[model samples]
Target: MKKCCVLIPYYNAGDTLLSAINSIDYDYLHPDVIIVDDGSQITKAADVLKEYIGPLNIILLEMDSNKGIEHALNYGLSLHGRDYELVARLDCGDLCKNNRFSKQVKFLDENPDCYLVGSWVDFTDMDGRKLYTVEHPSDFESIKKLMFINTTFTHPTVIFRSNILDSVGFYPTDTPAAEDYAYFFKIIKKHKASNIKESLVNCTIDPHGISTIKRKRQIKSRILVIAHNFSINKYAVYGIIRSALLLYTPRGFTVFLKTFFNPNR
Candidate 1:
């Protein structure tokens, strides 16, 4: 079997870290689970993770102070050798479906030219009960609909070839909120990309997560993404304005009614 490693970046996620770790059924696909501790103040996370340290090759990289997710991910990437073909990502507070790694690895093995592969996800509550499903777009056009909006790919469910990182480099540290989206724009829009049309992962969302609280930051980062990808000329401006009015309209009777009635929304 080809080697794969699960790279998890941790902060103050002591509350849900162990459950995320345990949810990975290592018996089926024993990938090296590397946890990059991004200066988590929650000391109990260390104790909880210690219990499972011996059973798996759990490598922990601790930073003296809290750097952001990009730093932690770069640190994790630095620890691995060139032997590993695939690097899988999971956030600290998220859980992976039982066969997440198995299915992704199989897809990559069959599709040699494909650099990155992401799966559809079912969003769940903190208790791990299913709330709703987020379907992924099957082709490039449908995926482009997410240039301003980010409904195409769930970050945690993505697995990419290590070489792509070598080519495009690590996640952007500058744009903190939409770093993943910015990276996707560079890789998929600038370069070429592909996705597998399979629902292979479950994404858990904490209602009070940082991503939700920092809405303005996320929107600002997205604006940068638009500026970087599209030319600031008249034609691009018109396209962006149309997309913004269609996609980013506030939650109101009109917006909700349109989304509710539209099959794609």
Candidate 2:
């Protein structure tokens, strides 16, 4: 088995989970995989993965109740720690570029001091139409500064040094939709993290929950994360103000802004 492990949290994704798995570049490394089911009734993890024809090392863990992604992630991490050096996150319907895993492992190996590294992501629609490209800062200093504003690492594009779990534990449960924001902040506070300059993942954005209610909860949780956040830098102060502004900013306006930045229509 390879030293890396891919963790996917599942919730009735149907064939899209296969799309995500098929994008893994097994040529570089067929790492161990763990799929955690978030009380999925319609699409059982076993049935969805039955047709998969790759290395037969995938492990499926099912939650009895619909606890949510945060719980599924923690459950997977707590049980799948079979001496992996790295843990990569992948979500259903997302596609990884061919060199995604190889580049992340190589980066971590070369820079032993770095505990986490994400890549730029190509955001797209279900029909594979490009929405926008998210390019975060590639260097550690820039990443640190940007974290004061928002999460630089998109969930599926990130690969973490497994030891960070030993150091920081699992994702924070109270952050609601912004659990990832708080989770990364806790780690960035202690370890060096960066992003690859180039896009290595196709992150499919679902427009289902982009409503006022959901966006308010997410922005509120993010503001909480930034307010309790520890930093003496001016960026931290600006971050609080920015998040507060986002709490009032309309989600549609932000979507329009991001769409305007999309190089592809």
For each candidate in turn, the TM-score is: 0.82, 0.93
Looking at model 2, report the run of 10 residues with the lowest lDDT sum.
Answer: 205-214
Cα lDDT tens digits for candidate 1, 129-214: 66556677756666765554553567888888877776788888888767787787766754434556655666665656656555
The number of the candidate with the highest TM-score is 2
Residue 94 alpha-carbon offset, candidate 1, angstroms: 1.8
- Candidate 1 off by > 4 Å: 81-83, 190-192, 231-265
TM-score of structure candidate 2: 0.93
Error of 2 at 167 (Å): 1.1
Kindly list the per-residue Cα lDDT of model 2 for residues 122-175, writing each as its tens digit: 888768988788888888888878888888899889999888887998999998
Best by lDDT: 2
Q: What's model 2's overall lDDT?
A: 0.85
Residue-pair clashes, model 1 = 0
Per-residue lDDT, model 1, residue 1, is: 33
